[model samples]
Target: MSGDVTLLLQAWRSGDAGARDRLAALVLPELRLLAGRQFRGERAGHTLQPTALVNEAWLRLSGLERIDWQDRAHFVHVAARLMRGILVDHARRRDAAKRDGGQRITLTGLDVPAPEDGLDVMALDAALARLEQLDPDKARVVELRYFGGLGIDETAEALGCSPATVKRHWQAARAWLYDALSPG
Candidate 1:
């Protein structure tokens, strides 16, 4: 299945529209799962649902002209990043309309305790941007593990690194993000 996804991705990159459609069909379920995880702690009346998120990502992905997709992991990494952007944009718009009372999301699976009140989506995005400036590799680890909903082995594969390295980066990135997002 992985090989099939990779082949389809390659064909799509080479301008095969049918391959692109097939790839979307093959990957939409996983993308919805990933998007669903992202919305877990969101407000009950949130405007964007998992399927909407997946559709939005697919629309954005379809508009790309020159993405050298590597494989299933690579494609998913991009999709996750796109979904994060969409969430952040939505949160920002909501905040603008509500005076900073936008949707907040709980941080989990970081192996570290999250805040009681949950964290602001924009705040996390800002902290992640700062982390990227300081240590891009670690930031990528967080993006993969947190935003991408990727496990250690999958992250390692996407990053072309060992699981041990992924673990280290994940730990370090989570600690850094925790401190950055914590109120002083």
Candidate 2:
């Protein structure tokens, strides 16, 4: 399975359309399963269903045919990024269609936490962008840790850093992001 996935990735990166489809077929089930873990706290009757989230993520991933698709960790990181984009885009669309314009996530049993200071998806994305500019590694630590569901060890391995460094960077990045996203 690993060899096949590697071949699919190589072929897809080499501009083979069939390889892209094969790559999607080979990787999407695991991707969906991983994505499911991130939303287990979602409320029962929430309109933002897990399937929609997974499908959106897959669609975005399937479109990344131009990159040099590397091994497992790289795949996971790109998937994480695409998934975050899907959620942010969905939030933006929901806000556009709603009577009250803002961003929020509805967790299980009905606790909807609004973004700090009416910060919508765009604001969050912009904050992430700024974070990326100031410290790309820290921003990526946040993405891999939170969105990719990677542990510190795994993130450190993916990032070619030590576990202790990953942990420190993760903590610092989260604090920075929270402050950056928070309303003054």
Name the candidate that leads on TM-score.
1
Give the Cα error of residue 78 in candidate 1, in Å.
0.9
Show pairs that collide, candidate 2. none
Compose the digit string of candidate 1's lDDT tens values, residues 42-136. Answer: 65677778888888888998998899989988887888789889888988888998996676776777543445556787888898999999999
- Prediction 2 TM-score vs. true: 0.77
Please give the CA lDDT of all the candidate structures.
Answer: 0.84, 0.72
Assess the local accuracy of residue 145 in candidate 2 as a C-alpha lDDT between 0 and 100: 74
